[model samples]
Each structure stands twice: as C-alpha cells, then as structure tokens.
Target: MDTWLKESRKRADSAHHVVPIRSGVLWSEALMRQSMPPSTADPDTSRPNRIPPDVPRNMHDSYCELLLPFASSPELLEQYINASGGIRTGMLMEHLDSLAGGIAYKHMLGPGVEVLSKDQGFYMVTASVDRLDMLAPLYPVRDMRLSGQVIHTGRSSMEVAVRMEALEKDGREQTIMLGRFFMVCRDAKTHKAAPVNPLKLSTPEDKQLFALGETHKDRRRLRTSVSLDRLPPTSLEAEELHSLFLHVHQKVFGGYLMRLAYELGFANAELFTGCHVLFVSLDCISFAKPVPIGSILRLSSHILHTTSSEQFPGLIHVGVQANVVDVATGKEQTTNDFRFTWCTDHNIPLTRKVVPKTYKGPCGERLGFSEELLQRTLTSKTY
Candidate 1:
C-alpha cells in the first residue's frame, strides 16, 4: 500500500509538456506520449511519418462520450446494486467521484476534490464513461476515450465540460451522456480552498460544453438543497468503517458514519417524512480501538429535544455500536458508540403527534467511557 501511494505521488508530481498552438490554446503532448509505452526502436533511427486514413466521424465523437455505454451497461448496474445496498444515490456518488478524478483532473493541473453538492440521481443512466468495471458475473473491462477541457473558474470553484464516446467498438456507437461538473478544489493538507488555473478552450465544441456548464450551475445550486430524507435507513458495522477507511481519503467521505446516524434517527422518528438533515455543525469522531471488519453494527437514533426558533427541531442523537467476536480467543466485544444531531424542517409542519417516552434499544451501558473525558469527541457544524 505504501509503495503504491509513493508511485502514485511521483506520477502526480511529474511536469506535463504542454504544446502551444494559437494564443490561448495549449495541448499536452506529454499526455499523448504517456498514453503510449516506450518504443523498442533506437532513438537515432529514422522513422517514416505516414498519413493516417480518414475515419468516419460519429455524432458522439467526444471525450466523455466514451464513458456512456459503460454507465448504461446492465452489468455495471448489477455491480452497483450488489456493492452498496442497491441504493442508487450511493452508487451514483461513487461513479461521480470516479469521473471527477479522471475528467476533472484533465482540466486542473493538480490533485483536487470535486465536492458534489448536488445529487447525480439517474443522470448517469444516459452519461458516458471510457472504461466500465462491471464487477459482474465477475468484472469485465472495456476501454474508451475521454476528452475534457476547463470551461470556467471562480474564487474557489471551477467547472469542467467533458465528453466521452466509443473509439473502437465492433458494434454501434451511441451518445450515452453529456454534462458538465463543477468542482471546488482545496489544498490536500491545509484543506484551504484554491482556484483552478485559467484554461484556454481551442475548439468550438469545447466552448459549447463550457456554455452548458454555466447554464447548468443555477439548476445544480437549487438541487443541492433538496434533502434525501425519504430514503430508508441502512445499518453498518465497525468492520465496514474500517473497510471504508481503506478506500476513502476525505474526512467528509468518512461521514458515511454520520449517514448511518441519520438513518437510525429517521427510522425512529414519530413523523418519518418530516425528518431531514438540516445541518451537522461539528463532529469529533475517534476510534478507541480498531473494529474488525464484518462485525454487525447496530445503530439507534432519537430526538433528544426540539427548538422553535431554529430551522428544524432541537437535536437528533444517533448511537452506533459494533458486535464483534474474537476468532483466536473466542470472546465477544460489544459497544463502540458515536452520536449525531439533526434539525426538522420548520417550513413544513409535522402532521403526526410526537410519541411520548417510548424509545427502544439497549440503554444504560457506559460500555467505553473515561471519567476524565466528560464531553463527546464527535461534533457537527450547522449550516
């Protein structure tokens, strides 16, 4: 793992050779060179420069166009369903993260995060991708081409327009997806935000995609506010958190733990439909001991109190625990816990009356606590 990370970092630091054409137009010959492996021919040997034959142009001939068929594949759908509880939102988040890393990086010169404030729900059903990892009847690999260029940049955000299409398919080529993604990049270590370097769009096609991104930004801003309170709660174990840690780098991504908290609390809500994730102001999560993977994680949540002045109710607290068993020594370990708070939507009044003192689940066990530490470690910040 350490070696892999080192090699990845080295590749990220290498300078890219940018080829200059007309003013405001730059292309990376280094990217093309890297796409091909080193040739066996001697450097001094003369080689013939042959003219390539003309190929039929397809309507979907774009970088992001390559990604569409993969996104639409039945095999890819099956893999998504199997991995994360068949929840489309989770699967879409994972896919957007993958695309943002690939296409978004093509426009940004450095490593960055594309914080997806809005949901990409069912959008990929028609989007494009170059390679689709259908971890199906086992995973199968398909290759396609991607073309992405930067459209706009702001104080702390940048937008990239991407197009993907099939390059060498024995079958028909189709327009699977076309869209723009807005990204907010930050310094990896400091977490302070940064701006994307100015991009020079050379093609009319590139200009068109950039314009689309500008128009889409307004709709995206509104959708970002749409709450996902209708989804049913899902459970997780300590082992799952450990497994998640192995893959995710961002602390915000690790907030899947908090997602579990929301799930637990909303399930127990007297008015389930009225519950929403109003805000998470501060969080200070710590792992006292590493929970083994595959442990049954149980979570329970409830409204501790309510507030009239606030946008939502008072606070919703969620408790999480892991059910673990030692394989070598054969002993059971229970009780790893965390808490979360949520506010109700004041604009939408609750129709159901609140239930009185009827909370259920394991209670009164200070399984892991220290007298010296009176306050909880995890905290949240409200919006």
Candidate 2:
C-alpha cells in the first residue's frame, strides 16, 4: 500500500546536509550540528516543503503502517504476551494513541516531513478516544500490522481511525480491531485552538470513512446532550441498565463504555507506558426515576455482598443510591440505585458482608430478589 515507511526508503539531502525526512527516522543531521556551535542563519531561511494551512490534504497522504513481527521474533513477542498467552491489549492501545498523534502531525506537515519543528505553527494532542471496538480476539501466533490515516477534520479537531490486523502465515490479514481517536491541534506558541487542513475525499472509501467520522462527531454530541451525568436515562434505557446490573456485561451498557473509554485509556497509561487497567464491570441496579434539572442529588453507596471465604474472590457488590430533595417540602427521595464491581490496580476489601441500617436498605435488597419483579417483567409486553 506504500504506507509502511522503511529504512531503505530514507534518503539524505547532502546539499543542505539535511537528514532523511520520514516518520521513523531516529537520527537527524542536526545531531552533528548539536556538537558544533549554533548557526545563526538569516531568520527568514524559509523552511523547506512546508504545506500551507489552507491546502486540502488527501486521506492517503497521512497513511502509515507499523509491523509487529511477532511470529518471526519470539524474544520480542515475549514482551507483548500476556498471562493468557495473547497479545496485551493495553500495549496496543498505547501504540494506537501514538499512531493517531503521528497521523495528525503528518496531516499538518507534508507527507515526508520528519521533524515536528517548534516553528511549525501547530501541534497535535490526543483530546479523547471516541471509540474502540474489538471485532475479534487477537492471537499471539500471528504477526500483526497497525495502520491508520486522518479521516476527517474540523477547525481545531480531527478524527484519526486506526486498524489492527492479524497477518496470517499464508499472507492473509484478518481485521482484529478498530478505533477512532480525537486529536486537537493547538498553535505551538499560543497553545490555543488552531485550524486544521480540510480533508480531500477522492474515492468511495474516502467518502465513506469521512462520513463515519462525521457520524462519530454527531454521536458524541448526542451522547453529551443525554449523558448520564447531565441528563437522566429514559425508561427503556433504565430497564436495559437493570439487566446490566444483573449481568454486569458490556452489550447492555455501550453508552457507559464510551463515556468511560477516555478515563480507562489514560488510567492504563499511568505508572508506565503499558500499565494494565482492567474495566471489571459497571453495574447500575436500578434507574428508578430521572433526576430533574437543577435538583441537588445526594449520592451514597452501601456494600451488599462479599463472601467471607476467598474461593470466588475479588468481588464486592455495592449498592449506590441517588437521593434528591424536594425544594418546596425539603424531603429527600431515592431516585437511583447502582451496583458497581471493580477490579484493577486498586482494591476495595470487604471482610464478610454489610448490613444497611436505613429503612430502605433491607427492602431494596429484598426487592432485587423479589418474585413480583420477575412476574411483572414477564407480564409486560415490552420490558
């Protein structure tokens, strides 16, 4: 695809004593210049091959691929192998973040421009990860390739889509995962929002990808409008969250997953480059009623179940309640119940079990297991 930049493709400009201008070039001619005194050339010694801000950039112009030759190098593959003998997903996530940054910089600089000079006017930083969908499990036996391009751009933000493929021994590439990273360009000097080049869509694939990016933007806006923090869930969404509380599975709470993606990504990056942070499960027991706008919510949680024996360990069922006060009467009403189970670097230890002293405590637990709840759901035409 002419996307993988190789060492052989790197060339030097002897006339200006310039180093190879490519993404992966580790060394620059400036290394030698660093040993000598700084040269004060005329201030206006215009930088070479600088693409203008208004120039429309093609999707392919920012295309780059990185090959992880796991099959060929066993020693190197050991670094990425997890306890389950599979490639570590967290490391791949860190790399995806890195690749997205490079693609954004590539779109700003021309195709072959290597160094991100301070005078380049703009630089890119990861604002957030809009989405990360793992289509299939990754295999440790196969070599892998990661590739991505700048799909769409706004005034200061751009969408970078990355793909991971498992390269089979027989020369087949199976898609393993797909992700979209949102990057923001800031003026290098001022650190304010900077304009990004427009994307030039030339083909069907380009147009389709660009459309997906636009859809991402729209969906992000929609979620922000009705986010769990700002707005309450509808009856249907609340019911789904009830099922999520029962099972603590991902399929029922995709919205919460998207909301938590940015935090999870950065949390995993803490301590070291590829530290692991497992998203154990987010459980909401019940969304009884929506909190009205401008209402103050008093939130609290109670630990429910924990086995005294350590046989089936590392789980503590928590019930969190959201109470809102009536402004007129000054009476608090319980409106939400949440069950959270977490397993990451930090641990919350529970010795035996918890007994809630409040009037609603034992009743809430009993209601969770009541036969009437099941009967009511069964009688309903739609739940």
Candidate 3:
C-alpha cells in the first residue's frame, strides 16, 4: 500500500502533466429555503412523537454501518461485463448508490421514528459522488465487506462515506475502495428538495469527517464555475479517446450518465491496460446540468495519469466530462466531471507499464483541476 502511494504521487508530480481554477459560486440560499416548505401549521397532536425537532444524540440516529460478506461470483461478473471482457463499473455504482440511500434513510430517522404514509415522508437521492478511491482490483473468490455511514448533514443534504474491503483468507482485511456520496432529501409527494433531520456529531472521528464534508462542498463550488462551459479538446493527447453519444427523449437518470461515463472510461483504460481492467474509484463527480428529454448527451473520456507496480501492474487514472449539446445552435453545456481509477486484473500480469501522455489543451486544463481536487480529498497513503 505504501509503495502504491509513493508511485501515485510520483506519477502526479511527473513533468508529463500541465492542468485550472475559476471563481467559486455560492449555492442559492433562497432556492434551498423555498424547496423546503414548512410542514402542516397545525400538526397532528395525536402523533406527537413523529418528526420532532429535538432528537437524541445517539449512534443509532446519525450513523449506519452495514457489513456484507461475500465474493464477486463468476456469474455476477459475467452479468456486468463490457465488450472488452472487463466488468462494467455501472453495476457496482448502482449497488453503492442503493447502499448510500439506505444509510441516509437510517441516519435521518429519530429513535423508533416512523411516519405513516399520510404524514410527511422524506426520500433521498444521490446528488453527487464526492470521492471514490479504488485501492485494488476485485475478482472472483475474493472475500469482501461493504460498509456505509453518514458523516455530516446540511439542511436537505447528507454526506455519507462508504467503503469496500477485501478480506484475506488469512483473516486480514484491507480497504479496496472508499467513497463519499452526497445525498439530498426530497418530499415523497412533491418530489422536491426537503429538509432532513440534522446529523448528531459525537465521536472525534465523526467531527473530523464532518469537517471533511464541509471542505468537499467548498471545492464543488469552485469546480462548478469551471464546468459551466466545455469545448472539444484540440490536444493530440486526446487523439486516443473513447466517446458515447446519446439522444434523450425523456428525462434521463444520473445513473445512466454515470454508466455511460464508466463505459467510456473503461474503454479508455483498455487502450493501454488491455481488456482485463477493473474499476477503482470515482472522484469529484458533479452532475452539473440535468438532461431533460430531447437533448443530445456526449461523453468524452481519456486517461489522465498512470503508474505500474511489481505487485499491482498497470494502474490507470481516467477523467471523463459530459456535455449537453444543442443540435440547432451547436452550443454545448458541460454536464459533469469525473475521475476514475482502475487497475489491470490481478490474474493477468503486465509486462509493461501503461503510461498516459502528458495532456495539453482543454483536456490538460481539466486534468490539472481534477488532480488538485483529488489531492484535497485524499489523505491516506493507501485506500
């Protein structure tokens, strides 16, 4: 793990890179306030225990930890493969998204609190994936553990951290993937943003995680400014790219976009790492503009950085950007920015390193900004 950290840092600092900043934009307070309409003026006195403002500060109220022990069965992998024989990252992402939603639901509850359907109900949806660090590759027969917890909260948003761990046959465990998911609460009926119960910070670690969540929010504001507009890259480094174009006739889901980006990223990985690459992590993923029906969605993906190791060969980091294009005006609106990390399947030994070229032009600019964002969120030497 220490060696992997050193190698990643070395690649990041290598001269093969050139990378951006824009003035940060603040979230609309008024919009947030309006999204959360006050509940009934005259509450039902019969159910006084429901949705109270004051809740106890207990671990049960603010934290959710799940442990699932299993292996990525051959059948599971077979069900999620791309044309290149690599597993589709979308399958894993969808699972994690569901898990994050469960954590948020648990954290938002008061002790023994349950709401009847007639009463106000809160639902959660993934707003963004702040950070994902893939520490190692996953394959069949590898024992695994998946866990999630709510680290912080805003008026209507919850910051949750989830991890995937690989347990060795010798009774040792190592984290293979770590991620931060931002979830937003919404009214079940109105389907609009709604207030959620605040998180109760107790342990020192909880406080620390909460502070980290705050920092991510700050960085996201800066990222949003630069992601407002995007142009096709002119750099020769972008020549070996992978792309996907979709025409939406109905409101598109964020997961669909994530899946497309994952496909393109994995495709880019294959250009150098071969057909056996496995997903690592996704960093600084922000869904900038929601795509309605009748929009043209384009995704362009390229390798950003890479390194090789005797123990784990052909590690590649990929960056992806999505745009919504106007077919008539030929204008494009940048929709999302994502950084994905993957490695060659352990079963396959890499005789050579997959080193990506130094990025230039628009691609370089985006890569530089992504690298900066990655440094801020990554604190551990290894996943």
Candidate 4:
C-alpha cells in the first residue's frame, strides 16, 4: 500500500506539467523560443511514458489506486471531530474528486493523444456525482485505500468509478463508499466541450461496466428532465430551507457545495426522523450550472422516505435541491439535485414517518416528479 501511494503521487506530480497548456499558446514552439534564452531554446520537458505502459488506450489504462494513512488533524478539526473520530464527509469528497481527475488524466494520456500540446489538451470538470453509496462508515484511525478507474467514455464525457475502503487493524479491508463521477472533457483553449476517446471493451467486465454507464446516463437524463429543483419550492417546504441559504460573496468551491448539500440533507433527515444521524449516501446529484461568485445559494432538503436495514434499522432519505437566488430579480434558478441518506444514531428505530404534503399546482407537479425520481433512485439496482 505504501509503495502504491508513492507511485501514485509520483505519477500525479508528473502529470502536473501537462495542465499548463490549457491556454493553447503556452506550449507553442514560437512562444517557447521567444520566452527562453538562446542557450535553452527547447528543453526536452515532455517526459513520455511516465504513466504505466500497460495503462493505455482502454478502460484498463485509466486505473488509479492510492493508499493513505490518516494523521492527526490540526487544532480546529481535531477539536471538532475528536469525539466522533472520523474525517469529515467533505474531506472524503475532496479525495474522491482528486483521484477521479487523476484517472481521467491517465485516460486522456494514451497513444495518439497529445500529452503536451497547446492546441489540444483534455481538461475535465466533474459534471455530476451520479451515485455515491455508503457501504460503511469511516473513522479517522483506519487507513484509507482508494481505487479509481474509467468505466465508460462518451463523446465528451467519461464515467469514473471510485471506491473507498478502510483498512482494519488485522489486515482486512472493508468497502466503505462507492461513487460514480461523470466528468466532461472540454477544450483547454475554447473552454468548450471536446471530443474524448471512446472506451474499447475487450473483456466481459469491460462490457458490463460500459452497459452500467449507459444505464446510468439514461436514468440521469430522465430524472433531470423532470427535476423538481428546476421549479420553485412549495410554501410548506420553504420554511425549512429558508434558514439554510448561504450568501456566497466569493467563488464557489465544488467540495464546499458538496458539504453544504450534505449538511442540508442530514439536517432535514434529523428534523423528520427526530433522530441524530450520520450521512450514509448521496445519489443522483447533478450540478446544473457553474455557480458564480456572490450568488445567493439555497439548499432545500425534503424528506422523501425512510427505510430500515439489517445493520441500521432507521435510515432516512432526504432530497436536497440547490438553487441560485437572484436577489435583485427575486427569482431563483435550480443549480443541483441531490439525494442523501442518513443513518440514525445509536441504531434507534424510527417510528415516525415524514409524509410529504400534496402539491396541486404546477409547482406541486414538479415536486411530484421530484418524489418519483427519489423513489426510483432508492429502488434502482446499481452496478
């Protein structure tokens, strides 16, 4: 595990040199000649074959694995999580995004792909986290092992599967989290969606994963078409979300948005279930648009359903909607759709149920579709 971590970090460091060409002019021969002294007109900076030779031009080539040992946190976080003894969900998300990006970079760094070209470089952003199923809880004392791989690729999008595992003291590894991220590749120069290499399936596993990706994409489109967050919230649920709005005056961070969404969902879960809960999973999350700085962001968390499991008897599903409010115009635009599940604290059984109020108007219909989407996600079988 330690060796894998070292090698992964080494490759990540090497890949850093490829991102600077995003300007589509920085790596130009003419620019390099003009910028460098006569003694060093062109340096052999392109270190080819840095990534593993076996990992090239296929779903197998995009594999990335890492092992990390948790260290003592700083005073602030240490004090905050000391009692709980686990890393924050936000921290986990940051690692997931980073690993997925590394895998995507490897997928785009194969034969016939320009590794360092000013005219072309595949730049990808996390389009959505389609599904994140928490298999178990993670604590700070346990070492973390992460595996990320490209499962499928489309014209300009790639689906990366990332699984989180916790290493137990006795050399046993347990799956703690599983997530699929949809990343869209864009031209570094034009900042427009760009073409990506298609997935070449050579094995049965490859075919299965590819089929799963296709299914997920179709479900995402269907759910997005009838997204309730696209419409304004009904008056009943507005009161709960009113105080959850955060006035963002600075640039929005993806990890920050994820954390906010989780907090809102968990809060609503606690409210409806009347039980202290911990975040278990997030599903069907979509980032509708880039959130600009100074946008008034609101997270509306609605209780969709509650179910019991063998390990955790009381589990609550909360549907959260992220909206950007235009205070000047008194209008709001839907930005994200998130479904979060929380496990009740102390394994308490939840006897209360949160039955959503009926929506009879157009907004109500939108919310109705939203409930159906949540139900579908809850019942759907995922790869």
Candidate 5:
C-alpha cells in the first residue's frame, strides 16, 4: 500500500499539465491546439481516427455558479405539511456529501473494487472528502488514483476540489456545479481517529478543479443564509389555521417548506386538501428561531408564483411564519419563518379561488395592523 501510494503520487504530480476543459464548450476548438492523440503514435494502430465535430453551446449557467441562496418550490412546501415529515438542514448536508463521495469513487477507482473506508472533513466552514473509499470492485485498493488537488489542509482536516457535469443532446456537456469538502477518517466501530493515506496530486488541472471547489465552498455558505421578507398574503379559516400551527415544525423535517405551503393554499380557499404537493427542491432553509414544545402558534402563508409542467399540473411558491403568544403573561414572540415551493396533480383542475383583497389584524380597523402583520411573514431564503 505504501509503495503504491508513493508511485501514484508521482504519476499524479506528472499529469498536472493536462487540464480538463470546462464542459459545454467547443471541444474540437480546444483539443485542436493540443498534441496528437496517444493512439496515433502506436505502431499497431490501423484504423483512421477523426476528431468529433463541434457542437452548439446553449446552456444555463445557473448550474455552474455555486453558493447562491435557494428557495424551495411551492410543491415542496406543501408536501411538508401533507406528509408530516420533518427534514432538517443537517440531513441535506449529509445528502450532498454522500453524493460527492459517490462521484469521486465512481470516477477515480478502477474496476472490481468496493469502498473499504471513507472519511470527510470541513475547512472554512465547508466540508470535503479526505480519505478515498478503500474497498473497490474492479481496481486493487492500493492501485487506485484520484485526480483532484488539495486546496486547504488543516491540523486534522483538508479540503479538496470537485465538479459535476451532464451531457446534453447536442453532443455538448455542461458544467453543472463545483465545490470542495473536508474529510477525516477514523475507526468505524470505535470512532477513533486514523491517519490519511499519503496522496500525491499530479496535474495542474486537478489542482485547478480543487481550487475552484474550495472557492465555491464559501459561496455555498453565503447562499445558505438568505432572508425571506417579501412574500404576499392569503386568507385562512380559524380551524385550519389552528391545525397548521400544530405542525409547523413537523413539516420542516421533510426538507421542503412546500409541504406546509400547500396546506396554506387549502386554507386560503377555505377548502380542505384542495392542493397537493408534487415536486420540491430546497432553495434555502434557516431556523432563525425555535418554537416551544407546547404553544398555540399563529401560522400564515402566501403564494409567490405558479407555472405548469407536463409532470405537475400546478406550481406555486408559499412563505410561512410562526408566532406564539403566552396566555398567562400575555407575552408574544415570533418563533419560526420559512419559504417553500409547491406543485400538485389532481383529477380536478383548480378554480380561481377568491383571496381577501385587504388584510386586517386581530384588532379591527384602528390602524393598518393587518398589513403590518402580513409584512411580518418570513419571506427570506436565508436560514
């Protein structure tokens, strides 16, 4: 294992000059400037080879940019309420890290191998995979090679670079996302610290990707802290509103605010279960404050926008706020705020539901209290 590690490191260091071009660009244009293919120099080569034609580049750059705050789709918010699952931010982090690990193993490890062990770390508030998965299916564990560079190495942790891409129908590939993670390995059962295998980075391209991943780590941190202070309002019945209050925290566990957001849609129409949550992607989540275990919380939500796709018939955005008042002392405090995305598919189409044209607070007509109350709704994506 030690000898293989040393040799692999040497090879990786030597390969540093071969940089990978960004996906979704004109590959022929870029490769044309480089040396001939290795196959051309082999004496046994018989068939003629040709460079593939260039492809048009029409891509959404949003996938490439990292670290911007995200908002949940309306469908996701509603699902939160309907399913009563409580998805947390930490779970989301786990999912992201797991996906990253899968990508690294699939791309780096040779055949006939399984991941024997894996470890991760975090630096500058961003996490990364440090130790490679040991047990691989196709390749000997000691013969495996990784291509990314270390951007930051700490006393007990390090951050390495990574990126994702998808091939388009037009024979073009697009750069999806780039970021870094921290990693540290330990004994699986005892949970004691372990040493990292010596790794040698070879290529400049690998170093560049690793560096980009580190930079994106900061951007992702920033995006996760957005505020939602600009959502509109909808009306609800007293009974339905009370039910919503009971499950504000419960629905958040599902990771999409849209589950709860769709419930608000039903309340707005004075109808029960009129809307359904279909698809949801977390845009942002923030636990600005916590809700007490037992409290009668006032909950409210509003629609952001709606569109239709072939899979889902309706799409919408809903924002929610939770507030509680102490009955004994008459003291009240805002507890939680969130935003969500919602969508639904039902046999019946939704009729235009009438929403209250004007909002009035608990007290009648003395001041523009209703508008103030509505404005208090948490609409920011930061969490």
Candidate 6:
C-alpha cells in the first residue's frame, strides 16, 4: 500500500506530458474523431485486438488509496459543501471515477507508472460499473478516503472494486459507500480488445473475491442474452404485468448504481427525489452500445425487484435502460442498463411493495440472480 501511495503522489506531480485545457471546442474535437465517408462515418466497430500473454499480478499490486481532508481543511470542505450544508456527493463521485481508472492502469502497468498516454501499449476504458451503493449516509465536515483494486480479470477486461470511507466520531474507518467497475483494455493503436494482467489468488480471501468477479461477468452475459431489444419479454413476465394492469386498470412506470456513478438513484441529478430512501447497494450496470452525435436517447426506469429486511420497509431493486435512435433510418439500439438498491422509509407501509402496472417495456431480469453478490457487497469490507 505504501508503494501504491507513492504512485498516487507521482500522478499528482507529473513532470512529463501535459496538455493545456482548451476552452469550448470539445464538440469540434469529437466530430474530427468520428468524421468519415458516407458509408463509414458510423461504421461498424473494428475487430477487437487479440489478447496478449501478460503476466498475472497479485491482488495487492493494484491496491491504491486517496484522501481528502475535509475535516482539517475548511476551504476544501467549503468547495464540497452543498447549499443545505451536506457535503457534495457528486464531486466525490467524480473522483471515484478517476480513481477507478487509475487503479485499472496500475493493474496492467506497474503501480509506479503515473502517466496514462497512448504510448503505454494499451488504453483502458470503463466498460461498465456493476454497482456503487451507499452503505451509510454522509456526515458533514469529515475527511474522506477512497481505495480500490482489480478484483477480477477476463481475457480482455478487469473487474475493479472500490470503496469510500469516512473517519467516524469514534475514530474508526466507516465505509460510507461501496462500488464495482468493469474496465476493458484496448490496443493503443488497433483500438480492439487487449489482454490484461490476471489476478493471482495468493489467499483464500483473494480466491473468494475473484469468484465474485467471475460471477459478476457471468451475470452480465446472462442479462445480455435476455435483453429486450434482442428478444421479447418472457411470456410469464408479460402475463404478470398484464394481470397487474387488469387489477389496477391503468398506469405504467419509469432506472442505476451507476456504471459511472448513478448506483441507486437518478444520475446525481439537480433534484434529489429519493428523500425518504437510503441507498443500499447496486447490482449491475451494462453498456450495450455508444450514442452517436445526432442520436436521440430514450431512458426507461423500473423497480425490477425488492425485499424487506428485518429493518427497513424494503430493499428496492431498480433498473434503467437507455436506447438510442437514428433519425435518418429510424434504427434503434439498446445503449445501457443499470441496477440499483436502496432502503425506503418503513413508516410508509405502501412503499414496502412496488407492483408493476404494465407489461414489461424494457428487460426486467437484471437482479434476479444477484442476491449473494449483493449480500457480500454489503458486509465484505467492514471495520
């Protein structure tokens, strides 16, 4: 971990290669990257590069930590302070995204490498985030610690687990949030899939974590096989939705533990609607395709599954699927799916059970087989 800390310091003190931030030309820059002939502008994705025989790394090799001294630095706390005096969770979430990426690079390259330029042989992109659930509510004016490591690896992708902790009043590290991100490697030049260093199961705990990562990957493939765009909703599911509609006589419904940061609610939007809800954990997030410049996106969200623990009213499982449509040809593609969990107020008995009123519109089988994963996430890294 000391070595990991040194890498973090080196990242901040970059002595080589820096690009000046340009003001307001990102739209043009994106256009330049995708511009091409009529038949190739949105050409089918190129073939992914083959996996390379990279050496496997011990689970600890990619471990790293970062700290934000909100307790000691009034000025820093002021920057993250919300209008209502609560700390800004969004700003810290953005930091998590960067930290997860940096950790992925550390897993593939050595922990000492700071700069992430194309010349490093491979580039990494966050393919998806399985979940990032808030274990507990945030406290004001406290220091924050974020740590992560690559828990699982595939032929071309890695599953990275990250946790955010706070120093509690009793001087203990209490986890406030837990998250998992799936990152894939691409050949710097070929831009296809590339092999990542595998995980070395040096201990029983390491083997268990690796197994969970493997389960996560298998769950994703299963979800994809049942995606709404590719196949019709299961007959039984449709029947259930129809029965609910007949009994209620009207209505419909509407979404992540973020792959990026939206684990159990709307993407840290301007309005915080889940006032009575406490975030629990996220199940999974899937990115099916990329949205092009002129494409229009339609998002649909639903509480896919729910359960009551001994405490809260219920642990609500939810999902949001985003689809993109092409104006010229009216072609649509599934872009993303997100699964999240949160505990609502037990005072409201009605909130305990959320029944669907319509037949399935998007896929609804996301968290059906994720109970073990969810429980492990809730209890795994306790202090």
Best by TM-score: 4
lDDT of 4 at 30: 61
Clashing pairs in 3: 19-368
All candidates: CA RMSD in angstroms? 18.6, 15.6, 12.9, 9.4, 21.6, 10.3
* lDDT tens digits by residue: candidate 6, 224-319: 665544576698966643332121101110111233334324332112224455556655565555454454766666665556545554556666
- Clash counts per candidate, in order, are 36, 0, 1, 0, 72, 10
Ten-residue region with minimum lDDT total, candidate 6: 247-256
Residue lDDT tens for model 5, 233-341 = 2345434332332322112222222234335543443232265443232232333333544566666765533444454445444445556678898777654444444
Tens digits of per-residue lDDT for model 2, 117-189: 4345555656556545455556788898887777889888898877778999888777776666777777755
Summarize candidate 4's per-residue lDDT along 1-383 as a digit string, tens digits: 22232233343333332212221233345645656664465454334443432333556566666666663335534633523465677567766776776677767775233334322233667777877777666667767777767787877788988878888878787777788898887765456566776777766667777788898888776554445555556787565343222221133656578877776676677778775787776766666566876688887878776777677678787777889999989899887777677878898999987665765212223554355544534443244
The local distance difference test score of each candidate is 0.34, 0.55, 0.58, 0.64, 0.33, 0.59
Q: After superposition, which runs of candidate 4 have C-alpha atoms over 4 Å from their true positions?
A: 1-56, 71-83, 110-122, 221-251, 309-312, 358-381
For model 2, what is the alpha-carbon lDDT of residue 164?
79
**Over the stretch 41-91, how does candidate 3's per-residue lDDT look in tens digits?**
223312234354344333334333333343536555456656655445576
Give the TM-score of each candidate: 0.31, 0.53, 0.61, 0.68, 0.30, 0.65
What TM-score does candidate 5 get on C-alpha atoms? 0.30
Model 1 lDDT tens row, 256-303 = 443454445545542444544333222213332334444445444544
Rank by TM-score (best first): 4, 6, 3, 2, 1, 5
In candidate 6, list every pair of residues with a backbone clash. Answer: 49-192, 254-301, 255-301, 255-302, 255-320, 256-263, 257-262, 257-263, 258-262, 258-263
User: In candidate 4, residue 278 scores what lDDT?
Assistant: 77
| Candidate 1 residue spans exceeding 4 A from truth | 1-93, 110-149, 161-169, 218-383
Where does candidate 5 have its weakest 10-residue lDDT segment?
Answer: 56-65
The TM-score, computed over Cα atoms with residue i paired to residue i, of candidate 6 is: 0.65
Residue 350 Cα positional deviation in candidate 3, in Å, after optimal superposition: 11
Looking at candidate 6, what is the lDDT of residue 300? 61
